[model samples]
Target chain A: MALLQVTDLKTHFFGRRGVTKAVDGISFDLERGEILGIVGESGSGKSVASLSIMRLVDHPGRVVGGSVHFEGRDLLKLGREEMRTLRGRRMSMVFQEPGTSMNPVLKVGFQIAEAIRSHERVSNQEARERTMDLMELVGIPDAKRRIDQYPHQFSGGMLQRLMIAMGLALSPSLIIADEPVTALDVTIQAQILDLLRDLRDTTDAAVLLITHDMGVVAETCDRVIVMYLGKIVEEAPVAELFDHPKHPYTQGLLGSIPKIDEKQEWLAAIPGTIPNPLEVPTGCRFSNRCPQVMDVCHHVSPELQVVGPGHRVACHLYGETGTVDADA
Target chain B: MPDAVMETRHLVKQFPVEGSRDVVHAVSGVDLIVLRGETLGLVGESGCGKTTMGRLVLRLIEPTAGEVLIEGRDLGALSKRELRRVRSELQIIFQNPFASLNPRMSVEEILRRPMEIHLRISAAERSRRVGLLLEQVGLREEHRNRFPHEFSGGQRQRIAIARALAVEPKFLVLDEPTSALDVSVQAQILNLLKRLQRDLGLTYLFISHDLSAVRHMSDRIAVMYLGKVVETSASETLFNDPQHPYTKALVSAIPVTNPRLRRERVRLTGDIPSPIHLPKGCAFHTRCPFVMDRCRTEGPVLQETGGSASHLVESHLVSCHLVDPA
Candidate 1:
């Protein structure tokens, strides 16, 4: 069995306007020790899906449907107390913007120790020792000296490493890192990504990496799932996704990036902004912006269908020679 | 180039440490010229003095030394009244659109205030100009009444751009204009800036840490390091053949989207050294891949490289050590 399998997950927010379908009927699985990249633009539900898996969605937002199966147990079925026990011990999350995620008042060492003791039945001294070990593992210099400092004392890159250290304190089975390097500089981003890759190689934990940068996914992930308006539009191995992306949205996203070698007059942007979740389009969420959108796409939502080996795309343009009409 | 839009000669700025005798050398001995209707990209890491150079170009902060010339007039020597006159021709678009904008002012008010003060336009003409500027930035007329909080990040940036345009400035200091935006929104903003540049014939001193964005928009790129410019060249030439070790490391660090192609990572292990007390010789020597003994003690001057007459570098003065002395 896969280490984690999310089947038909639907997370929504009960807002004043209506039910905002943040992660509507999305499903993917992470094999043991696999790095699965969830790539999408802002509001594509990539972050929401990861948050839903961890049951960290705040009030007004709830998992309305689907099962998050981890190690043969449905995470959605667990009670609050049971989920809390499994949270820090069995799974940990590294959020985006470490500057905001870390507590300003608490010392970095004590905060990391709190993460350790919350999951494990350990003394304060034991937790501190483990925290230092984690800090060293994440390539922090002078672990003992800087451990007593606050988050603000560290630079943007160092704070990110601290967050990673906290995430690995429990040696969790899974790590859901959501856009961990988004706020960092490119050079620092490359370093932190290398650290994550090295950690994955040495540990048994599966990483559910969520990011909007396709380049990061190409470099780090073994597999990728492309999300669009709360749906997995494409799923394939990282190599396959880059080489042969089937969905129109995925193609547009790839085209939008300014390649290092090529100089174009304009980056090919998708036509429209992401539709508001409160009034999501009925048939295909991306049809409004898709260049190959068709009449059928307007009325019928395409199911995820297998195309090539280990590749799946939720578009009418693939499978049984699925044809898409030219949109004008 | 008597009518060059903006020019700076050996511009130097330092921030004093509160309780100590030390100072933060934010911008040190920088020379730059932006001709009429040109975009000069100032690229560097954080604390590398790119933003400080932008501010100095517009005289937003008082420079400790050096000259700031706009339209062949020395801004540093200008009186308070003369400086106020210069402000009408020079404006800045900040990095964070939300922070720079006044939350209390409506979009129309924000745009109109600049014209009312700088251009001294009548109320009816001010309203008309605000509407035209809004239209120029792809904002609808209805958005004029909305406050900064009522718009998304991208929309707020458009409003910021409109406000910047309201002054009818020939020179614009765009300090990381699209860094806070999404990738698609960034493309939109870039396209908008390009269109505005062509339409208005504006000269831009664009400051950013993002090389990709800089490459897209700039005609010439200047690479800054620890408060000094290390290299200045055409964007394409600099990216293709960077002579400076720091510039080469920066070029190689850009993440490639192609899965098949793997690039060598020039990982700079140590952190960027403190600007409070920069290295005596090369500020980048501590993290440079090819470090020589002379690099620790001898400072290098900017020199024209062998590749192009336009290409200038300050490290070793040459790629080969034998061709040049320390």
Candidate 2:
């Protein structure tokens, strides 16, 4: 069985203006020890989907309908106490900003130990030893000395590592990293990504990596789900998605990136910005900005359908035809 | 060779720490020359002094030492009134458009303020120029009446650009101007910048951490380490054949879009050392993969690599013990 399965998840923000369907009807499955990437821009609901799975949506936002099945148990159906026990024990999250995520006053080592002790009844000494081990594992040099230092003392990269160590303190079965390396430098980003890859190889934890960068998705993820305006527009294996993106949105995103090897006079940028969530389009959310917008696309939404082996795209162009040659 | 529109000779800036004698060596002995009508890309991680160098060139923050020469005139030696006159030729567009632009002022007012102060233009002329500037940056005249908060990230950036170009400046220091925008929007802004450069004959010092964007915009590129320029070369050569160890790691670290083109990345270990207590040798020696015995004690100086001198302005220079002797 898949380690985690999300089906028809709907998360909405109830504001004075209107309901903002942040994560509107998204579904995917994460295999054990797999790195699944969720790629989207700011309002595409990629972050909200991950937050929905973890049941971390605050007031004014609620998960209206969904099933988050983790290890064969529906997480949404669980009570408050049961859900609290699951968080940071079997499932953990790493956010983008490490500076604000950590408490300013506490030492990083103490925070890791607290996470470990919250779930397990281990003694102070055991937790402390395990914390040091985690810090060392995440490539923190002079772990013994640096363990006592507060989050303010650590650089952005180092703080991110501390956050990763905290997430791994309990050996969680699943990890959801939301733009884990976005705030870091490229060189430092490479290092953090390497550590994540190593962890995947060594441990049984599945990673649900959420990011806006297609390059990061290509390098780190095994499978990718492209989100647009709170919906999953395309899903495919990493190589297949990059090689032949069927959805126009995905194609635009891939084309927009300035590749390190190739130089072009003009990047084929998408025409418009992402639509405001409260004022999302009626039929297909991307119909307004899509290059090949059809009359039908403005009236009816497309459904995610298998177009090739382990590849799925939601677009009117491929609705009737199972596998239309997108390039041709 | 094209004339050096802006030149920095060993420009340095040091900030004294609070309640301590220690000083943060933010920008140390950086030598750079920006040729006319060319973009010199300055790239580094945060706290590597890319922004500080940009600010130093414009005299936004007073440099502790060295000279910023613009068109053969030393800005430091200029009188107060002369410095004011020189400021019209040099302008900067900051990274955050939202914060940099005043929320209270309308778009026209913001763009007009520079013209009113620098150009001393009449009210009617300022309005006409504001419309023209808006049109140039791909914004409509209607946007001029609205406040900055009403515009999107891209549109706000357009306004910022319009303001910078209002003074008819010969040079611009674009400090991560597009980093905050979305990928698609970033492309638009980049394209706009390039178009404006061609149309107006503007020289740019494009400061950004995004290497790909830098490569796209720069004629020549300079890779900076902790408070120093580690390498300088033509854009194509720098990307294709990075000579410095730091540059090599930076080039390899860019995550490629295609999964099939998986290049082996040179993973530099550890965080960048703090500027207050930089390593004795090379600032990057602590994290460098090719650290040697001599690299532990002696620092390297920027030296010209073996290449034809057809383009003296674009010659490749690297600062590494392994590449060239100090």
Candidate 3:
């Protein structure tokens, strides 16, 4: 069985203006020990999709439809108490902001120990020792001395390591790290990514990494999923995605990056900014700014169709594999 | 030699620790030269003093010692009125436009208010310039009437750029102007800035942590490490053959988009040292991959690397013992 799978996940927000279909419908699966990356801009619903799978969407936002299966069980179907038992134990999350995610008042070590104790029955001494070990595992030096210090005392990089240690407190099988290294310096960001890679090598921890940086996705992930305004625009192996992106949106994204390997006089920037979630375009979400936009793209939503072995794209330009009837 | 549009000589800024004699060496003894009509990139991690350096050169914050010179005129030596007159030739664009611009002000008012103070033009002239500014920044003239809050992040940044250009400033300090934006929007803004620079003959000191963008935009790049510039070279030389240890790690840390083009990793072990308690000799010695005993006790100074740096703009200065001694 796959480590985690989502089918037709739809998460939307009920605001005063209208329903913002943040994650209208998306589907993907993660294998054991694989790093699956989801890439998109601000309102592409990549973050919301991760939140939906964990069943942790906040008020006014809900998972309207979806089935999230993890370890041979449907997480969405589980009761509140049942889901709570699995959370922080079988699966866990690490978000972008380390300073806000942690409790500012508590001692860094105490907070980590509290998480461990809440999930499992362990004595204070045992939890404390385990917390230090976890801290050291994430490359925090002087873990013994810095254990009692508050969150403010730790640097940004150390604080992020503490968050990762918290996620690994109970030895989760799957980790949903949403922009884990986004709020970090480049050198520190590289170190944290290496730590995650080491974790995968040493254990069976499948990571569903979410980020807006295509460079980070290219370097860290095994497979890539490109999302645009609540839908998957393209999905493929990391190498295939970078080399041969069929979707115009994907191509635009790759070209937008300022690569250090070479120099270009101008970047092929998409024509317009992202449309408001409340006022999405009719047919394809990216049609408004797409360079190769077609006439039919204004009225018919294309389906995700396979174009190569294990590669899929939801673009009219490469829809010969599974043609969608425009009238339907 | 190309004339230095802006120069910082032995610049230093120190902050005192609260209720203590200890001090934070924010920007300590740095020298930089920004050439005319070229983008000079300043890159480093947090607390490397890149932002503080930007402020120091612009005279936004008074330096503890040393001086800033613009076009051979020492800004520190200038009288208050002289400094005010010189301010019209210098401008800045920050990362967040929402913070710099007032929420209640309309685009025309925002563009016109600066002109009223700096140019002292007639109402009709100011209005004409506002429309021209909007059109040049790729925003429609209709957007001049809209409030700042009504525009998107990308469009608001364009307004900020237009506001900077209203005074016809020759030098601009762009501090992480695109860091807060998305990748695609950042590309648009970068391209627009390049176009405007060429059209108006502007000199830019582009400070950012993004190395890729730095490589694409800079004519020369300076690498800072803990309040000091560790390396300065032409953009291509810095990326292709960086000499300083800190620069090598920083350059390698930038995630390349091509998975197959991974460079030899020069891994740094620890986080950036606190500026308040920097290491005794080299600030980066604690995290450097090639730390030696001499590096532990003696600090290095920036010097010309080899024979290739003949031109002033192309000089490659690296502050490392492994390179040529000054």
Could you say which candidate leads in TM-score? 3
lDDT of 1 by residue, A197-295 (tens): 899989878999999888889888999999988889999998999999899989888877777877776777666566667657767778788899877
Q: TM-score of each model's B chain? A: 0.94, 0.97, 0.97
Please report, as a residue range, the 10-residue window in candidate 2 chain B with the lowest summed lDDT.
Answer: B306-315
Ranking by TM-score: 3, 2, 1
- Writing each residue's lDDT as its tens digit, candidate 3 over A38-96 gives 99999999999999888899989999997999999989999999999899999999999
**In model 1 chain A, where is the ten-residue run with the lowest total lDDT?**
A319-328
- Binned by DockQ into CAPRI classes (incorrect, acceptable, medium, high), candidate 1 is medium
TM-score of every model versus the real structure: 0.91, 0.97, 0.97
User: Candidate 1: deviation at residue A108, Å?
Assistant: 3.8
Q: Extract clashing residue pairs from model 2.
A: none
- Candidate 1, residues B1-326: lDDT per residue as tens digits? 23467778898999999999999999989888776787888998889999888878887789999999898889988999999988988888888987999999999999998887888768999999988999999999999898998787888888989998998888899999988876667777888898999999998998998887788888778889888888887778778878787888788878788777656787787678899999878777787778888778877777666534422222122322322434
DockQ of 3: 0.83
Candidate 3: stretches off by over 4 Å: A320-328, B324-326
Which candidate leads the pack in lDDT?
Answer: 2
Best by DockQ: 3
Residue-wise lDDT of candidate 2 within B1-326, one digit each (tens)?
Answer: 45999999999999999999999999999999999999999999999999999889999899999999999899999999999999999999988898999999999999999998999778999999999999999998888899998888988999999999999999999999999998878988998999999989999999999999999999999999999999999999999999998999999999989888777887787778889998998888998999998888988998888855567565899999898744
True contacts kept of each: 0.47, 0.76, 0.81
